[model samples]
Target: MFRWDGGPVAGGFAPAPAADALRQWRSPDGGLWLAAWGAEHRGTYTGWCVDAEAGLVLVADASLYDRDGLQSALGLAGPVLDAPTLLLRGYQRWGEGLPQRLDGDFAFVVCDLRKRCVFAASDPMGMRPLFHRLLPGGGFAFATAPEALAACTGLDARIPESRLLEPLFNAEQLAHFEPEITGIQRLLAAQWLRADARDVQVQRYWTPGQTRPALASTDVDGWVEALRWHLGEAVRKRLADGVRAGVMFSGGLDSSAVLALGCGYVPAGRLQAYSVLDRGNPACPETRAIDRVLAATGVPATCIDVADMQEQAAGALDALAASPRFVSGRNGFLPLFDRMAAASGVDVMMNGIDADALFFYEDLLERQIRAGGYAVALRCARKQDRMAGEAWMVPLVRRLRYTAHLPPVVRNGVRRWRGRASEWPRLHAALLRTDACEALGLRARARRHLALLRRPPPPAGGLPTQTLHGAVNLDGIGRFHARSRHFGVEMRCPFLDRALIDFAAWIPLELRLRNGHLKWILRKAMTPHLPHAVAWRGDKFHPGSHFDRVMLQPVLEQVVRDFHGSGPAIGRWIDRGRFLAAAQRWQAGQIEAVWELKMLLLLEHWLQHNADKVAFGR
Candidate 1:
């Protein structure tokens, strides 16, 4: 936090953040204040740094996976330095271009005394978050989380109703498109911000869509070898020597592979697996998958049977909802991580969130048919169907029905013959109140927003954006961030490693989209050593399949009956009667309104808890 001295609409001032960050520092005149929080992990910032001779004061929330590579690039000799020191020296050496040369998740601010400007940047993947507010005369303040920035002394943190409701316009498009959903400016992935007396500017520094790695021409076997090597290295470098790490073992291909790879780097007791098994759904597919993995690997594992924990977690809901930094995750699981941290001392967690986004499943089979590669498409589909225990003819016929050359009349006939789920726009629209959506134009805006995903994603993606979660473009969905923030534990995702992503980018489209499977190359590379059937399996059993029955029906009933059309913010976009009807329908085991209900519930909690204390402008 910082306050401009003698700038427009400003005087002598000091801006204080609300939360107790790990470290806080202030310049003599109180014109600048720096605060940071970091976990005990490689590339973490322990404290703020000031180089009077170099004319720089730096505060960073960073984790550089390739500190050795960065040090080598900067020509820094002598003993290894920390991430913050490396960032400071890199800024001196390469200036703003330093972000391009660096790898890993980072968000940092450098107050450059020589230039009289402050520079900030987040890593290419946005593994860390950065939010800021810019006032008149280029006076600025920023924090790692939006709520933190809102809490600082300098700005009107009261979010406007219009801004508060903007997210509903494209709630289906989950990440990045409207990162400012909380009504604060977010520095996007690969973006840099520069603020000075003259002006404040935000510019994107790297375009992942345009990045082309050099390994594109390698043969299939060579590509597989390269992927295995990169995957191993990605896991190895991120663990950091002597740092205890664990994986959220879901018994899925990605997490299972991470566990297999991680075992090579750490000892038996050092690496652990944490899983959430729903006691109610004991016979679910994931349970079977988990059984297979446990039978095969025999790795030490702890299962958090959450079907019984609702009563225990009940008291924390009000407090969790009351926080201004409202996170979008299973807050119900917060205690499980705390237990993991307390009992097991596992400080770092490796996640497999990026696999779905990076090793994308493509629509090339349909394209192959259109482009006259029928044999190739059939072969791939056959292999995929065999592995999935489905008949090979299903996808072949479906592909034929969906091919572009099929007339609309024929496609309509096929659709009538075999029912298909509605598109995301229609499905997501059902969640909002009809009157609220029309009045606020969310009905139209949501369609327009979702239509953008109809186009093909860049090479660095997992599924068709047309599919659900196509919006999950290698982004961490606050599960890790929420847990880390709540517990002060370090978290890392080897799959989000820049080098791994780059290696995945260069994989030939044939292998990437082959076998009619999502992340075919990744599975092919890992199956040899993954030890479990999950690597060869295509079905990913989502834990939320039973969430409506287990979680929502009981808890959300009160939220629906209790809420009237009264919130200063929610009522404008969510009609009380209509939203109540939707919630009622949802509680009756209907899932059409899941996203809208969940998001509105989150916002209602935010508004109810924060409206008075948030200091809204009169």
Candidate 2:
């Protein structure tokens, strides 16, 4: 991907960047500047400077799997076309329709000196991040990393308090609870942006809202067969020949299914599966299941026991803390895997994340009720129980509480209680400076995000099937990139394929969620291949004690010490008393997980380390 600064020459702009991360280039007259750094992931798609002199600068970070099909569709000559060339050829031939005809995970910018306009677009899931900032005077800068843009432009990078809620409350996926308003304005998935001297425009090229597909049957066999074909194709597309590849196999339905399908496409000798087992927790439930898959597929695996590498893991985590803000605190386990992949010479790692989004159906009862009332809802739920091999009454009662009529307060309370009452960490209101909180409007923003959780399903599509699609792109994929980039590995998620997602959307929910099992259709599809016990396994086991407690406990005092003396940058936002109180509770073992405390530490570390790398504005 290229990081560049550009604006209309008439606007009187000259781009300057501090970091040498990008290769710098300028037009002969010095009117235009470009900085790019890119590498081809697969085939011959070197994504930079197809014809620099022609003022045709194409920067694309892409994994275009169906090169032959796409080249044929775009009518490009020759047997193969690189992603950038494909886009450039498409632009020459079709202009704005280029993005729609291409199918892959990509983010790109094409500078057409002839049109005097810059065109940029992100793939449907935004697999690659594209962030831009309008310069102070009259210019624009874009980069893969938000901080890179900030560093180049010297723009404000102060963490927005409202955006803080995302990392603080939901650490697993630091997903945006609402559309972006502060921080870097990221281009969402399936969107295109065009900017010039006079004006800038952004629009979504694809919307899941309009993506519903009609299916003729609610039968398991029909949907399962379709899913098998789509999922196999998705996995096949993600595999790169001759590249050392690995899968983040956890032996759960998602990971197992990926590993099973992956072996079919990639040679078993070339493919290795990696798993993290609990330290000293020999009774780890996943081991037996993992063994089952290994025996069935003969796919080699290296299981890293968390207990064995405490010191190294701690050091890796410290290195992570010293870097910029990552999406989630739960990523303490990432460094271990990232290092494993790097050392094993695996440049590409596939994950089964978000399989649940497409495979498992949620709020089915709510959608049925919204469409056809109680009789239809109950009938659907009962049918699901029959397929799931379980009792439906209790879950049905649970779903009833979430019907449209219940007051939000009652619904929220019930959900909180059901989710677990004790472990949840409410925001420490007393911690922030009252004036800063008010100025930033964190309270109001938090309330708005909470309200979004209570929003009822839409009538036709239930919840936009795109929720997980957006989430994986916004938080999960970005986080993976941030960590994996350090090791020169590209992480791919087969489940996030646009075709697979569309296929899942087309299937009736009754078929997808059959019996009481989540991803019932997926289980049925795999039953022919994997042992039933491994294929239909219901529970996913997270190994050992959490890495945070294992890694952070030895260093707890240091975290507290750093906060107490964390300087004005941090103290201006977080009150000392509130932080100390939370730390005390965590030390006393009153709380199982101190997400807020971890967030504070991570934020504090990022600010201190990246002081020169980032600046603040609003």
Candidate 3:
């Protein structure tokens, strides 16, 4: 938080903040104010508050997964050290290099009073959250939660329509759009922000390209051997002492792999696992695969029924309304999950957030097409067919379409065709007021943003994989942290560990994905530990399936009623008449539209709840 050097504004700063301000730090000069609040994680150091000199102050909301790795890098040893102390020492030693030298889920700000500038960074995968705002005259404010900055006495807390249109336009690529722009401006993953009195600048400190192995090798078994070591160490690092850690088990390969590997470190009797089961929805049932892990490992598990949480919908909306950050996920069950964690005395939660992106195999054909020409791309496509024990032409055709040999027009035409083919049902045309959308140039702006995703991957980075790192990875992390923080639990992902990412970064794409398989190397590495059914599973659960199955009927009804009548907040951006007709269909049991409608409802509630805090530019 930033404040006036002194005077009435300084005194107005809250002496005791409500739920939003979990911890607080103020500059002695009365020019800056910073705070952290919420369910503080029990074991891991989050840099809740840092001890620093008068001119230099650093506050961090971080949970380092690889503390041992960081300690080894910093040359610290012996007894376990305080998280803040270790963090401050590293920051003081390496400055901006601190992010590169560390591996964890963190977002922190270092204020240089002497230089009159500030430096900020998020974890490589963006597991933690941070937001900043430039004030009217001078000075700036940053916080883990946007609400903290919105609560500032002097800062302009008006809502920006562009922020709302971002997720609407880009779909899942919201985090990749602009590292500095969200509902409020947000820092991108592996990127850092620096601000001075005159200006603010955001720069990338690290990228997957920077970590490509010194010697790239295509040996599959060799790659698997290395992955096993790195992946094991990654899971072990998160098994910190004293805390009762739990895995967010979904019975999928990624989470199952994490659970299997984690059992080696945590004893079966002490092991804990949690899964969100939809007892009511046959379409999205929790697979018996989870039972296999529990039975094999003897790890105790807890299952929560989404059916029980319909009553909490209002409270969830109220929570979403209170925060200024755009909640990108459609999951309506996290609030209940967190409450369960809190009740069960679980402090740290581990998940398999980016295993798919890390081990992406579908992009292999494209990568070969770009680098080794059509012949090479065809060979890979054939290899994929052979591995799958079938003749397949789709991979070959898809690879050829994206090759460098193709004209820009041809490539773009293919992309546009595919994009159109995959386009989800959007809000009805009548739902958006043409005058308002035109005034904001909503369609034009959305087109400009969508075009960015079509550009070729950098020469040094993997195709689509690099794009994943910059785009969805950043957005997903912020959403995860927001949901976790709401219940005061710290979430960690082992697959995102620096060592694992570095290893996965340089391995040949064919080894990562083959024969229509994704994360192929990961499956091979964990085959010994995971069940054959899980290791060989081919299908992925759509992210919205569970939410659609459980909450669609109830949530949609409430949102439709609210949208057509009392919820005029979203009307500022959407066309009310169009939305009303769509809502009618949604109400009449045409539930396929639930996914799109829930998003609008979330946006509507967000706008309505924070109406006073927002100022339209009109």
- Model 1, backbone clash pairs (residues 3+ apart or across chains), number: 2
1-618 per-residue lDDT for model 2 (tens digits): 222333333322223334323455655444455565443343323246556656676777777877788788866677686677777777777777777877787888777665566788888877777887665565556776665565466655455445543455453343432323333578777889987666789988875435544556655576678788888998888885456778888778888888888888877587899886664666656776888888899999977666676775566566665444544325465656766676777867888877766655455555545555566445556655664457754477356745545655776677655434322233453356666566666555545444444434343444355455444345666677666755557777888888887777666666655455666678888887787888777545666335555555645566567666755345666777777777788887753445556555555555555555433433
Write one digit per residue (lDDT tens) for candidate 1, span 1-618.
555552223232323334543655666555676655543443366456788787688878887777888898889898888888998999988888989888777888888655667899988777787877775444677777665566564445555443344444434333345543354677777789888877788887865424555454557777888888889898988776567887778878888888888888887787778776665676566666766776666677777554665643443355445343444443334434444553477767776776866665344445445556677666766767776666864466466745645655665455443322333345345445566545555444444444434444322233222221244452344435644645555677787677777667556656765766757788889977775467777665555424423444444565655664334355545556767777767767665666557656555556766765433321
Span of 10 residues, lowest total lDDT, candidate 3: 421-430
lDDT winner, 1 or 3: 3
lDDT of the structure predicted as candidate 2: 0.64
Between candidates 2 and 3, the one scoring higher on lDDT is: 3
What TM-score does model 3 achieve against the real structure? Answer: 0.80
Q: What's the lDDT of the predicted structure labeled candidate 1?
A: 0.62
**Tens digit of per-residue lDDT, candidate 3, span 1-618:** 554333212434442347544555566666766654544577655444445554667777776665776777788889756666677778878988888877677788887766767888888877777777786647767766665565663445554565455565444454444432333677767788888877778888876635555444656777887888888888887875656778888888888888888888976455588776665555542455766776776778877555565555454555565554446455655555665676687777888887877876345556656665456446555655654456674556464665656666787788776655443223233245666667766555545445655655334445225644745566676777677766667777888886677667777766765554657788888899887767766644433344443444554566557665666566667766667667776766565556546666666656656666544653
Ranking by TM-score: 2, 3, 1
> Which residue pairs overlap in candidate 3's backbone?
22-36, 22-37, 23-35, 23-36, 39-488, 431-575, 431-578, 432-575
Task: Give residue 52's error in model 1 in angstroms.
Answer: 0.6
**C-alpha lDDT of candidate 3 relative to the true structure:** 0.65
